[model samples]
Target: MTDAVLKIENLQTYYGKSHILHGVSMEVAEGEIVTLLGRNGAGKTTTLRSLSGLTPPREGRIEIFGNDTTRWPAYRIARLGVGYVPEGRRIFPNLTVLENLAVPMTRPGPWTVDKVLELFPNLGTRRDSWGRQLSGGEQEMLAIARALLVNPKLLLLDEPSQGLAPLLVREVFRVVASMREQGISILLVEQNARFGLEVADRVYVLNDGQMIHSGPARELAKDEERVRALAGVGGKEDGVLTAKPKTSAA
Candidate 1:
């Protein structure tokens, strides 16, 4: 448990009376990037939400650094060093980029405004720009920068590359890879199977609210047919089938 930054056992989540995630279980080891890959509405986001306490799981256990956090609230989970960047870039639209970075500094460790800016030079240039004024790519970088400011031990990213240009997606995945190099464990939920496999150390496949596959990323990448089938994409010609480019968005 100490070696794992996060561990979930048979996690189950729901939206009102509708069940969304069933018996979902996975782990992110220290300093590793673990990705959850699946088609749309395959419970990827719900898994992240449950772990982040946005929608607490109705059953199972959530352990962070070996401590039980199953019933913890969002804020509590966040304070425990879990930084969550949800599907949509949720920066404060009314605030400046700098202001947005300052909003989540609860009890900071190594992450400072200067550090965050250093990681995102684009944001540094637009330090005083309003969040709403930034482009989609810039907004995504800001969202990731803001999460890093929390100095999280475990980062939960939901669709980090949802809607972005090809180049921007590559840049985003590069940053995610850098985070792992810096010793930040990440649990990524992404639709781009190729990109996810490229950056992830391990991979888990979720379908219809349950995890159906789990293994090393390299192993899955080698079997293109299996990857395409699991992701529900048809072939290499389909842009979604092959994670050809380095880019992605949330």
Candidate 2:
């Protein structure tokens, strides 16, 4: 409890009549990179959404630094230091990179506009460019930089490498690793099991709205068969994550 930046217990959430999360529970400890891994429809994003109050849980508890925030609104959750970078790189397209970074400044401490620009040098060069003009990788960087501007204690990242090239994916994961080095706790929801394993200290797998596996990332990374089976991927070999072949529906 003392070291945990975010904690959830028996969390349940729904989207209209569709049940999304069922008794999902996990914790992100201070300065830890905890990845939530699963296949396409495994409720990984829902878990992060639930944590950030984007889709409030119908049942269970959410605590931020020991304070219960289950029923808090999204804005309130953000104020409580829960920064969420959603599935899409949802930066304001019409706004400049600098403006997008300035929009989330509530009560910032160490994360200033200049500091974030320095952290993301590419963004610094493109500060005056409209968000829509940036490339996919740059957009992803901007999304993360915008969240960091909030000076959050817990950062929620959903699919940061979803549509990136291999080189860009590596770069994105490197930034994620760097964030952990800076003492920022992160709850990353990713479909890329291999990439997630590379940066995560701890890993949890979610399936059909429930957490199926939880342990050290390295432990799971070593067991290729188990990772393939759990995450529906071809498994990592020679430091690369090969995609699993798709099968016809029976």
Candidate 3:
């Protein structure tokens, strides 16, 4: 238990024709809520894909739960107790809530069907409901519950709040915070900077597939300009994005 839950060094990834990620290094401590903050097309999702072995890094080191699984296949990495909830809540449209969770059942962690239902009571009420019948928030809860059922040591959630309503967004973060209290290491990639920082212990800012800044998440909230620049906030409405570098993170 003396190792970081998830660690990456100089992680680089490619998407076919061009290289995406540069030298990116970061770590998530056990039971800590860490976040990767960036805008659209900023390589945030690509980073998660790389870590999960979905988009294997061309050059880098990825260690999950103290094991060097860089060269391992996706199934191999997944079986090692790492759960990934992708950006879209990819639920089985025809399956019920319980059925969806049962799809990836590994079981060993502190999570159980009853406990997960308790965590999100609405799920219990909708157990027999089809995935397509639930609201966006309900679908998100189902995704988290399904991941928990796998008994993951580390959870990688990509844009959990994307396209959710304001209230549902708050609910999502609250759930994340509660998960941290229960000792889950979370790597969250979020476009909503305020929501991400609110629940994260540490935050990393990635630009053009390279990490530019990382520190206590609170420090990020204090610097409006820095947040605006690296995080894709405060950009004009021309849709022609320009890089506006600011002071580096200390």
Instruction: Return the TM-score for each candidate structure.
Output: 0.92, 0.92, 0.89
Once superposed on the true structure, which residue ranges of model 3 sit more than 4 Å away at CA?
Answer: 234-250
Q: Please write out the lDDT profile of model 2 over residues 123-234, one tens digit for every residue.
A: 9999999999999889999999889888888889998887777888888888888887778899998777788887899999999999999999999988888987887753
lDDT of 1 by residue, 55-147 (tens): 999999999987899998888888888888888888899999989988985556888889888988999999999999999889999999888
CA lDDT of 116 in candidate 1?
Answer: 81
Candidate 3's TM-score reads 0.89
Determine which window of 10 residues in candidate 1 has minimal summed lDDT.
241-250
lDDT (0 to 1) per candidate: 0.85, 0.85, 0.82
RMSD of each: 3.4, 2.8, 5.7
Q: Give Cα distance to truth, residue 17, candidate 1, Å.
A: 0.4
lDDT, residue 71, model 2: 92
As for candidate 3, its clashing pairs are none
Worst 10 residues of 2 by lDDT: 241-250
